[model samples]
Target chain A: MVVSLKDIAARAGVSLSTVSNVVNGYRPVGEETRVRVQSAIDELGYAPNLSARHLRLGRTGIIALAIPELDNPYFAELAGAAIREATSQGYTLVMEDTAGSYEHELSMIDNSRRQIVDGLIFSPVAVSREDVLARPPATPMVLIGEGVYDVPHDHIAIDNIAASHVAVQHLVSLDRYRIAFIGAQAGDHRQSAHLRLRGYREALAGAGLPWDPALAAPTTAFGRADGLMAMRDLLARTQPPDAVFAYNDLVAIGAMRAVAEAGLRIPEDVAVIGIDDIEEGRFSNPTLTTISPDKEHIGRLAVQSLVARIEGKPVEPPYDVQPPFRLVTRESTLGGQRPVRT
Target chain B: MVVSLKDIAARAGVSLSTVSNVVNGYRPVGEETRVRVQSAIDELGYAPNLSARHLRLGRTGIIALAIPELDNPYFAELAGAAIREATSQGYTLVMEDTAGSYEHELSMIDNSRRQIVDGLIFSPVAVSREDVLARPPATPMVLIGEGVYDVPHDHIAIDNIAASHVAVQHLVSLDRYRIAFIGAQAGDHRQSAHLRLRGYREALAGAGLPWDPALAAPTTAFGRADGLMAMRDLLARTQPPDAVFAYNDLVAIGAMRAVAEAGLRIPEDVAVIGIDDIEEGRFSNPTLTTISPDKEHIGRLAVQSLVARIEGKPVEPPYDVQPPFRLVTRESTLGGQRPVRT
Candidate 1:
């Protein structure tokens, strides 16, 4: 049965307005009366009608975090942080997986789903800046990752190009001349891939090495299988690279596997590095060398920014936030060392 | 600006009812009228208010998949399948990460969040059968995993004891006299852990080996760190086991790392086997041997069952569904073979 304020007041032997005050906290009630009303609510199994209440209040106490890939550990780790933060801030964070599809990403920004959520934290990979710009401004949005930029939204991401420069410079310091870059996309699909590829080229030039289009291998996706196939193709070349840089840790680990399969030793033969310090990279065969972005900062700040906009709190202008990142050197680049077990 | 049916009708130069018919499909409109209304909708960016519509229908086209760990790749893979299935079934699946906390798991079943979601597909780990039984039946819930049982819900899980038998037998068939089991919980919190432990003891008896409590290591949690610490402790014993059977793939991978750190060769010195063939195991240094559960079946079936119940379809009375599992041998158990690239 649908219990109403009258039913609760009747059971608690209080007035209907007193029960309403207790439920909505519009006014403070005496301790004894509050306890009686709470007991009555528990016995009646009263769940406040959130849909009606949200419609009246013009706020749903729920937000959405739209990500490109749910299976990627980097995104998963970042999402975990976001979920915790959203819960602590008194909101439910629902994840919308775009799977890096253009239509799905567009739907996330402009669809009927926007009516149910108070705000959105989006990590767009398939949608371009123009697509994001055309979205209606009814629902507040905070952008994360390097997919779309220069929009009127709170943007949070790491400096992808600088991170790539650090990764390539690490390999150069190890005296590796011929270096290959894996996970270059054909079109302007993944913005980070383009930025990382550009950084790879600039770093090579900075180190007085010629940029070879053959060495910049392209893959359809940034996954382990893609890395394995791309590394195999690179290895088939006449003068294979002695060092490899992959888009992310999953690809780097796959490339490392391909290197081992060809009976080649890491560092001594093909040193490898990647971005995203995922947990798998830590316990990998010859633990991976990677650029560790501050995932906690990116995840938490994105939620905070969106919540600020949702609540209409004083906020700065649409700021392009860049979280810090660092290069981690592991056994993949420096062999003959004991693997770190953390 | 809120674009309503009146606004669309005014823009399309049609009656309000005609625009309503075009939007809701309550009645078929003429082709020309439908095209005119759709173009007006596109121009005005009219999003049908789903919140108000769902409130009237008393159904929210949203389902939730609550899992214990979001960071675990096994759960992530399962969630990916569940999300796809939920999308195919015309429902938005929102993930609730309980993080294996008792309070969070309880909240998922008995809180206001239940009122927002149409149904729940929960993989509970911390809540008990009694806790689940006490939940309100207002919202439909489908339980996955072996944490809770004998509740009035459609339940799905792999045969944990049977899967464990296969894992232990795989180690015994390799002529490994001494075998260890990692990730045994202290109490009845994780039901699968107890079942797997019982299976380990039964398989040992079948092999005519004496049961050794020392070989069965208890962990605080079933994670990579837990397995690493437990395996390290086991290796410090007077006589370490020759093989290890882990709770899942993450623990098994950590145990392998510990063995490698101790200068012990895989399979020759210590063979390791894990359940849940996560992608990480496929690309580990020595590809791991695992009992692969049908995660796709479990993920999809749980969503389908919950969606059916939410839509008030006739369902079989609270089925205890058991999916299939298989043993996959890799270099971790059988040495002297090239690693499978795929």
Candidate 2:
């Protein structure tokens, strides 16, 4: 049972305000009264409801994680990691799924701030840089995605450009040419997609391969279904690429399935790679070869950064957190190459 | 941007409480002043902070969904569904991951009640019927997951015993006599696990097959890794079953992986099936066959039940909610039998 502060006050023979002052150290109280209140608190084993305590101090001990898709393995793992890190720091984490709506993302920002949350760890799908900039955030927020808000306020990101370049270059190292860049979100300049496309082009030039726009498979959405559809369209073309660097693990997994359905073997018929080392990627038919962004560590850093801001600590300039990345070599991209399926 | 009620009050030249009283319709106000205040509110586009309003009214438009593991796809899907349902009914859903800990589940219950959340939709992993009855709920709560909760609190459960019986019956229909029931947690009588075991045993008895404990592959935990380890151990035995019925989709998935590694063809060699038709199951190497509980509908009901209670509506006596179930047939348990991979 929770022992409320009122119970402590009653036992101490003091008013609620007196007990509050003693608990919060908000104002000076007589030594005798303070001692009596303290003893009463100790005797009752009072564990203050964190919410009330946070409210009095202009906080709520609650941080919200706003993500685009909770069902997405990437976001699920990130949420799990974040919840653990936040709970370890004596804070509760509440997850909000925006369901890939930009306007909904904005409301989440407003809701988290208004509903007593101390901070927000946001992974926005819809809201744009202009939206974030025009409406400055009311609460301390740490964003996890490619650069969206130019005006920095604690954004955590993996270098999409560098990561994409690495993914493509790794395929080139495998002596695979005719590389396809799957999941090209043409007009949507969401940092991750746009930057990744740019990196793919750069990597092609570096590999001494001519740019082929036809090989860039455009996807309407960043999911397995989109990848499958795009890959199907690519295969229907005159010349399908021998290799693909998908948008993310989901896209890659989908594209690989298409390859299998078309009677082709992984790596041998069409090598595939993606970003986000999600759990599904590890368990897929042929384990995925992808970029691992140490998401768990990044989650921990996000929590620590938010906590520092919540406690009124000064966060340094260049408020961007760039964690290290790894290339997970797996069967999908590596099993010894054989003659391509007709 | 959210326009606060305080802004409206200032514009109307009224005190905060007067403006609140007018907006809430708690007390009568002079017609002229009410019109003046309403116009000002409309002009200012004042939106009340739900949490603050709830502080006065004691019904925050927020509910928490507490689950064992957020990383688990089933829970993630359930959370996504719950979020949608709650949002449709004008409530925000906050997810709490218990991390498969009983103590954590208890704390989540306490925290949700203590925090601003008006109600809780909980799927507990640890706390027992004794713990629950001993410390009657402090706030309106609806429990999910079978029948460990005996006391009449709002509960949402899939009839575990019946579901398991159906699963085993399906496997038996496939003309497989040596059916192994995987993931039998012996001592821990958490409703789902305990009842599932009972159903499996009952199904065998009904089939006129003598109970052979050797074919019951008991698992220490309910994850894919545990499923894999248990299956591996079962495979090492001199007499392994011709078919397997796993605890859940995740466990089934792991066991399937073990079957593949052991050079056994799915269905053709060792037919396998599981419960919880998770998305991953649909896309596994050879698509998994499993039971599909209408989790989305169940999630919606959970929210509605809590909302009804929060609105002070009298909940009926039979607080248990049992959603309909389905058996999905897929390649893993069907597809024309190929020669055993030996």
Candidate 3:
């Protein structure tokens, strides 16, 4: 049987509004009456009709976090934090994998899922800034990651250029020259790639080293295989680089595998660094050196910003947000040491 | 403005029922009429009202895949496959992380999410067969993984005992007499642990090797850290085992880290094997030897089974399913060799 507020009210010998107050906490109810209504609800096995509530309030209490890839541990770790925060804030978080497709990314911003989700936290890889600006302004959206920029949305991301600069600077501090950059995009496919490449160039110039275009390897994707293949091509060059700066931890791991396959010692033959200090980095054979972004901060703040807008809570204007990040040195850059828990 | 079926019918110069049939494919429509209605829909920018449709049909075109951990790449890879299958099947697949909590697992089976999801594909870790049996018969659920058993539902998983036996037999073939088993549960938690332990004992007896209780390490969790700590404990023993069989690839990776930290060479000092041939295993420092379960097969079948039940398709009765698995040898159990793509 569908037990309604009326049924509980009748059982508790109180008005329907009293039961509503107890169930929704819309208003203060007397402790005695709340206890009485609660008992009636429990005895009757009452469950709130979510569909009816959705129709009446125009809120589905569901939010979506749309990301580019699910296999990447960086995104998976970030999504885990967002899910925890959303659950704590009384919302159900659903992950939507866009698979880095233009069509899927466009559909996420185009009200295709508006009816089911109250808001969206998107990490776009394929869509342009103009596409985001041209989208219908029906659903509230909070952009995460350095994909689309300068749109009127609450944006959360780490400073990609600064983080990249730090990673390259770390390699320079070790007195390594001819550093190769892996996972450089060909065009305006991934915005972060452009920013990271600029940082790599700037860091080299700052260290009194000439920019060599041959040292900048372009990868079609940012994965282990991409890193391995790119490193192989770099190693095939007449003068192989002494150090490498990869797009992320996964790519760095792949490069390390390639170096091992070629029977070369790390730090002596080639030092490697990456971004996103994922857990995998901590346990890697020679632990990875990386630029660590505050994922918990980014994930929590993205959901909080979107939820605040969804509920019409007064807040700051839509602006770019850069969470803090830091450089971590490990065995990949330094010599081998005993593993320590992070 | 909300563009309704009436608007499309009016614009296309067709009857409302005809438009409905064209939109829903309830009956065959001529190619010419379908083109006319499609153009009308495109011009009007019509999107189906999912909420209204939900109320009318008492079905939500969304399903959920709930697992214990998102940080674990096994689930992430599986989720990626399920998402692809679900998208191809014309349904939205949302992920729910139970975090291996009893309350969350119980709620997933007890219609708490029935209003939002049409069906569920669950990989339970905490709930028992009795708990599943006692759930209300409302939402269609398909079980994945070897957590619970003997319930009347479409179950898909690898044969844990048989797979475990193969893992240990591989170590036996290498002439390792003292083989240790990591990730043994203490009590009733994690049913697979018991089944795997049984297989381990059976394999040892078949090889005429004495079973040593001290070598069976029990980890609180099945993560890298857990494996690392368990391996440390075993390494401190007066006579450490010559081989280790971990619960999964993650644990095996952690154990490998411990072996490396203790200044021991893989395979020569301690041979290791794990289940779940995740991508990480393929790229680890010394690549992992593992029991390779067909993750794509299990993930795809889980969604297919749940979707078939949700659509009320006529099929065979609910029964247990065991996807194929095989032993894969790599650098961890053998001497190092050039990396090969799988």
Candidate 4:
């Protein structure tokens, strides 16, 4: 049978109130009495019920982070950062993966609102602008990435559009005129892909380059096969592009393979760039030239925002976290090339 | 103002007990009365407090999973599978990332014992056998890969040593000598890596191939860069090996890049193999030859083991779930040249 404070008190020849005070370190007691009470507590092997304590305080000291997929390194790193950030602030983080499924995302949101956690940090997948904007959760919530639907909640993210534009602009600056865009899915209303595509077009227009539909091929999925297929289709064209912009690091790695298979040397023949700057990108053949978003900062900011809101403090505008991005030059684009101008 | 149950009873024109019975569906109420009570509940925006209900029952329908790093695709996929498996069993999975820290692992175990969760699925990192076995938690716990000590709990893991042996044996059967083992770590007692290394040696001995000390090189980390560095160091030798076995898929990917950079053809110039068979392996150049573990099965088994134990059932003894490993032949290993000797 499990022992309680009352049992400890009875065993120690003390009142229940005194035993409670000793356990909580509330009221001062004589040194001898404290030791006796501690000995009794240890002998009984009592375990405090954190859940009951949480219920009494109306605070669970737990937070939930809902991500699309942990298999994706981007989300994985994000989760690690968030966990570290949350733990440092005295909150335990529980990660939930939805695998980018719409129904799963909705169910996770509903579950989070059920108070399993005091607040939620969600990177939703397949949530429409209408659904998110119209039905923001009635609990403390923070939105991560491009699914911001004008909801009045903290939104933490990097500049996908600017990052894309800068990446493409770096390629242009290298005088790679025939640039191809690969690994995008058409009709993806996700703010991330949509904004990045918009930035790609903007970069093209600013450089006085014609937006060639043939150069902007979309892929069915975001895996390496899609990247390879997209690159293969581009290379099969009569006038192959000198450079390719991939959706992410994995896509870029696959496209690089396709380029090598076509007997093309990186930079010397076809330049490539990607986003997310995954660890593998640093060791990819020719390494990868890409835009590196501050993923750690994004995670830290998301946790800070959620924790602050959960504590009932008036947080600065919730959508205030906008992490910076950097363009990492590597062998794919060659070093020290003046950026191409219109 | 929050509406209470008393208000709901008054609005429904019924006794509080009748309203409670109708709300909880305890006793059969008249259809008219049920509808009236339901309407009153909706009007009051009443949502039952599951936490309070759980406290009354002294049971929380939650399980916790503690893993090292989600940044590793294998672990991420494992977490996803575990979540799916637990949800199917009518329990919620709470994920915690320990970042492979021993202190964090201990904390998770302590919390689990403190009733933070009904049961735990823990994949501990940086923990010694004595640390866990010496003081096993009283709660139902399933130890995952990297088993510390014999904690008298269910363990779900693939035979890493045998899996690695199978991978090398496949290479040996191909008559590919001059083999190099990449990504070995010094003084690391992680059962997976150490056992896999042991299997590698056993396979070489069985093949009558002398173990070459120069061929076993340890890397600082298990990332792509570490793989690339190890591969490059091996290739720079006066006589490069004809084949290489990597610790995992990420390391293999790096080795592939290095081999390609050296203008070597896969399978023909240098055969490459790895474990895990990550999804990225399918799209890699020359694809990958790997030992595939049943990640989904391991995940499901972990959940079933914990849930069954929680219900006080005598789980199968040894609970040592050693699943089989399949050697998937890809372009990385010459399909036509695999020589079988008695």
Candidate 5:
């Protein structure tokens, strides 16, 4: 009869988990318990399959996924997707919150000294491309999200430029002119805001609409509070735009609130649109019109690519993979007779 | 001069992380690299303070926080809070999604045989109290959320019964007599649903309003989709209640959507209230009116409790904590007049 881990645990007078640990080497085992487990294993003649795999791969069988912050529904949702994908690929995804700090991101890279994680999938909101490239992480990593670094790494993100262009064109299709672009981080190359802003300008130019610099409102942060503040500033102007295209859903939701607070109607006085189809958008007042970049797919691709690189598979340079996006038309941008409660 | 890890890395001609691995004894180093690192350490007259700390405390300096899923905004926001609290305490918070499976939770406990994580903070959604207690994790653990496992370990959660009572009382004070309870898991004693349902009955009894079992709608899950379905089920009743008290914000938001889809005016037709003031609920159309249980405080307390237990501190038995809750009145449950465009 085959000696199972359970049989060894029983013989060693320890838990099944203890026997598994002694074989896996993922965690440090106590000296006395470890010896007892080894003795039981020797007598039982049992060898764990995972132990051989870990030894051959020089791995902890753990993958680290670093995101800026989980407070944002976008990142939180992305993390959930990443976890599912990682689990399916036979690795544990350990989430790390970089807290949107460049220094913190650098420190995480420094953690390679301990060699605890086998691979990394990072989505940085704070670290600059220059800073990231200056001191690269030693482990095989796949970059995901807003900005791409100037390093030979597998990158996964939705084409923010094309997606933004589609979102703006959708607003234009609704006969909305004098459109305002909220959330402009003009000087930041690492911010997706820059690419989205470019897309917005291109869409306006293509439609033969005159660019109004005054209509381009800038927000300090890509969050609801900042979006609200930016919308208020736009409204305070003598000639506010007839439409508002926010950078992301959080900004759009904030702008929606500002319009409601100002006693203005959505899609009538000012149409609203955004990117990133976060789940919150589904329940938002009037709902949100957005460009849906499949986050679950992005999560799956990130893990697959990182695992591929770790297994010494041939991955070519400029390993950027931009997933396709689709326009999601919802009530906010669709102007019609508002549904009234009977 | 005191030697640093950097010096050892330079002496060994290996990466800083590689030197760290050999010194920490947490990971397996290549035989050649291990030999080089040891030689470098002896020559450099180095004594790692971190190494001594790790050995003396039997700590990984990393804490594993296992939650059911981050797709739910409550857990997502709680994760953000926990990360911040863990950072302040000089511990790295490693997030693990238990996939809401009892087997997954047990497997994680089994991982403790390796003794990698110093401690654990678990919020189990699927595991029953008996199962969790019968096969306790080898590591020091603190349980948070939903059900409390009857073990010697610490537990942290909101007083769901009291919180639910207050939420129902608030609806009653609004002169809403036919109040329906959304999200009841009738037979599951391990679920907080039982306690919340009890609270709903007591509140109805105190107000001299008769309790109707038909009004206590059951949900398969504690998320948005289930809430939507449960609300639809309630609406199908011959004489549906005029108000709903949801199990949590996700369910409440889902219920709110069903109400709107049925073309019913909130507060006027069906005022809705829920527990857990998730961030997404703040932006939900008609903004959710709910109980704001301090999730951030709960996250902080769980880490603090686990760390205290790990440090061999004088932590008493039945170390359960229930932080206070506050009511947040919002647009969804206070419908009166429509804000018209100027």
Candidate 6:
């Protein structure tokens, strides 16, 4: 006879959700409760029939992963990591490459005529207050990368502001004035980018350096091309800054390319740094010195968080998981060490 | 007044499968039959109710994408492309990161008891024939990348042998003999890697050069670290090879690093090339000279084929998609030029 979650719950003397939570390992059950559930499961030889459960729940066991695009390796890596985590947890992920579009993102959530998934792990290109509040999914949802400030759901993200500040501070500590900012966004509310930019400003202010608007160039997108464009624009300026902090590695790579095109050497003539510490960053012409997000950890955490929420567990206040970002000072930012902060 | 596949099928006087085939745009119906289907769909305003149809068919509207690892950009890009295409066809994708284990791949399929979605797009790292046929999924399956041969599923992959042949031929054309083959897998049926290796040998055979086993260093895994180790091993041999052909871009990057560590210059000292012209390949130290699979096209086609199979259409036999791979020779193989191939 096929043992069921119901039978397990009955034997364990717990709520059905509790049985589900135990089976899913989404939430931490009390030791005694867990032992009872395990004993009941072992006694009944109960197997979680996903197909049957899927039928009753009307769940497709599919989740939508709305990422920006594949052109950038960061999104590619994030998507890959998420897929790995999701599959392990018994969820299938379908991808929506919006190329960072508000309309496409909104359409993805709004146009329900075509989707059959139970939840969404949306990483929007940019977040709007209206967009965040307007359409929260009726199904289980999780937010990654971008934060939906007012909207509450399971969110997994890196502290963009803190990450940027860390990056800028690293550069400043190296005593490299004439620091430039690349890859700023106009009216950006994704918070990460704006916050990172803000961190750059704060670091400069803390260092008593004048905030130079000419030094900050906002690109149209977050990628190699955008980085190159921003760097090229910076290079063409009357006074190109010495050390440049790019939005991410792709932008940093682009800036390096533009720097090469301009016949200036990296770190020597113009020290360059970036974020997202993509694998390529380590092998670029002048290996990039940048801030890196722990992609593997993030992926694992996102899945664990979603699974928890699915089981109705109380998680940490929906704050970003500031997985320690590392500054690998490579050829691009090789300089004499600066004094440390107390 | 929701439009359904049945409404169109009834109006067209065709089987529901035929109607589904038409809607998914997989099989080619006769001109007269096409017209009838179109007219029926138009008259009924039969917009596919992606959700309810998914419910009735028990389609989670999710497809599982199993790849080795996203740590490598090639798989990451492939996942992104697959997800994007799947999204366009109104399907969400569930990703499974196998990390290159046949057991893991098999377990994912076996445990697919969830009936989450209608199909799977699997890029198996290591699945034996017996194992594959032993517990095949009731749902349609499409194989991508690794372990294509003998798998009873619709397989989508680049012509690895031909692509490798092209890489070697390009190296030969440059008259760089004493070529070292880096990142050759020891024992594997991943036709792409094996074929590419064969192609390298074939090019040598075609050019009347000896296939030097000493120069062929096989690596345990296809990654940067492995590539470096393989290259280092090759460099330590009796006589260093003049040029190197890596299994993939990550391998190439690793080999490039090893060459640099050994104080050799790219192309000038030891020309290096790779396959899967990953994004980083273009921006690497010497800019990798490699073969580029139309990954975007591959991803789109995989989804299209899987969707067709799930919708019960007669898909073409599982054959290698020898989509035109280009020889993108950059700074690594300095003198080589890119042949304009799609």
* TM-scores of the candidates, chain A only: 0.86, 0.86, 0.87, 0.82, 0.84, 0.78
Q: Write the residue-wise lDDT of candidate 6 on B45-117 in tens digits.
A: 6654344355335465767777777567777677778878887887867665676766567766664433445
RMSD of each: 6.2, 5.7, 6.3, 7.6, 4.9, 9.2
Point to the candidate with the largest DockQ: 1
Candidates 5 and 6 compared by lDDT, better number: 5
- Which 10-residue window of candidate 5 chain B scores lowest in summed lDDT? B333-342
Best model per lDDT:
3
Task: State the lDDT of candidate 5 residue by residue for A87-120, as single tens digits.
Answer: 7777778888887787678766554324467888
Measured with DockQ on alpha carbons, how good is candidate 3? 0.39
lDDT of 1 by residue, B1-342 (tens): 988889999999999999877664444477788788888887888866343334334566788888898889998899888988988887778887889999778878874554357888889999988999888655888999999999999999999989988999999899998999999888888999999999999999988988999999999888888888899999999999999999999999889888888888998999999999999888787889999999999899998898888877888888999999999999899986575555
Candidate 4 clashing pairs, residues 3+ apart or interchain: A154-A318, A173-A339, A173-A340, B129-B148
Error of 3 at A332 (Å): 0.4
Writing each residue's lDDT as its tens digit, candidate 3 over A1-342 gives: 889789999999999999876664344567688779878887887865333333235576789999998889999889888988987876778887889999778878877566468899999999999999898667799999989889999999888888888998899999999899998888988999999999999989989988999999999889888899989889989999999999999999999998988888887899999999998888988989999999999899988998899888998899789999999899999976857582
**By DockQ, is 1 or 2 better?**
1
Q: After superposition, how far is residue A129 of candidate 4 from its true place, in Å?
A: 4.6
Structural similarity to truth (TM-score) of each candidate: 0.88, 0.88, 0.88, 0.80, 0.88, 0.79
Cα-lDDT of candidate 5? 0.79
- For every prediction, compared with the true complex, DockQ reads 0.41, 0.34, 0.39, 0.31, 0.40, 0.23
Q: How displaced is residue A161 in candidate 3, in Å?
A: 0.7
The fnat of each candidate, in order, is 0.57, 0.37, 0.54, 0.42, 0.45, 0.28
How well is each residue in B92-119 modelled by candidate 5, as lDDT tens digits? Answer: 7888888777767766655432445788
The residue ranges of model 1 lying beyond 4 angstroms of the native Cα positions read A1-57, A339-341, B1-56, B339-341
Worst 10 residues of 1 chain B by lDDT: B49-58
lDDT of 4 by residue, B1-342 (tens): 777769999998999988766554334467688778778877777754333233223345678888886666777777778889887776767788887877777766654333346788999868777777765446778899865646677887788878878888889888888888887767775556677778888889988998998998788667676777888889999989999999898889888888877878888889999998787676565678898988888888899999888776775764677866798888788633221110
Report the Cα lDDT for residue A61, model 1. Answer: 77
- Which candidate, 3 or 5, has the higher lDDT? 3
Candidate 3, residue B241: lDDT: 88
